[model samples]
Target: MVKEIERAGIPVVHVCTVVPISLTVGANRIVPAVAIPHPLGNPALGKEDEKALRKQLVLKALKALETEVQEQTVFDK
Candidate 1:
């Protein structure tokens, strides 16, 4: 699906916990996520903190979409 979107000139940044699966499936831009069940948030965190974390992850994914890459890239920073 990610490749299909990119094939249509739409860039995709896949945000998920399973980095290897993302790579195996040929996701060009990937963001390492928090967990399998909740890829963007941590339940142990306070509500505000969880929201902040999710926002940060989203920002990272957006940044990845803006960048060009020749191979699978992990935007874990």
Candidate 2:
């Protein structure tokens, strides 16, 4: 799907929790989130904690949209 979108000359951004897997799948524009089930928030955590985590990871994902790179990338702390 991502490749197809890019092939159509449309810019693509893949926000994912799994970094290595996305690269294996040939994802060019990828952002590494925290976990697989909840990319934005963890249900087990308190509301405040979940919000903070989502905010941090979402910021990383947004930053990725602005940056340019040659190879596959993963945003990690």
Candidate 3:
């Protein structure tokens, strides 16, 4: 689906816990997720902290989208 969306000229940033899978699937923009259960938030953290972390991850993904890349790129937080 990611590839198909990009094929249609819409860029996608895939936030996932599995980096290898994202790479294998040819996701042009990839963001490292916190974990499988909670891809954007860590339950161990306080609610506000978790929200902040999620926001940070989303910001990183947005930055990745703005970046120019010749090949698949993974943005780490």
Candidate 4:
């Protein structure tokens, strides 16, 4: 699906927690989240902590939107 989208000339920004997987699959724009299963938060953590973490990562993703690059970019916190 992602490759198809790219083939269609649509710019894609992939938001994922895993870095290597996205690159291996040839994703153009990649943003790393917090986790694999739970990309936003961990249930084990407190609500406040989880919310803060989510907010921070989301900000990073937004920052990624402003930059232009030719290769795959991973936003890490």
Global fold similarity of model 1 (TM-score)? 0.94
lDDT of 3 by residue, 1-77 (tens): 88999999998999999999999998999999999999999999999999999999999999999999899988874
Worst 10 residues of 4 by lDDT: 68-77
TM-score, structure 3 vs. true: 0.96
Candidate 4: RMSD to truth:
2.0
Candidate structures ordered by TM-score, highest first: 3, 1, 2, 4
Where does model 1 exceed 4 Å of error? none
* lDDT of each residue in 7-59, candidate 4, tens digit only: 89877777887778988898877888767889988788899999998898777
TM-scores, all candidates, are 0.94, 0.77, 0.96, 0.75
lDDT agreement with native, every candidate: 0.92, 0.76, 0.94, 0.79
Count of clashes, each model:
0, 0, 0, 0
For model 2, residues 10-75, the per-residue Cα lDDT tens digits are 766687877778888877778776678877788999999999988887777777767886776665
Please list the residue runs of candidate 4 whose C-alpha ends up more than 4 Å from where it truly belongs after superposition: 6-10
Model 3: colliding residue pairs = none
After TM-score superposition, the amount by which residue 51's alpha carbon in candidate 1 deviates from its true location, in angstroms, is 0.3
Which pairs in model 2 have colliding backbones? none
Best by TM-score: 3
Instruction: Assess candidate 4 and give its TM-score to the true structure.
Output: 0.75
Model 3 regions lying over 4 Å from their true place = none
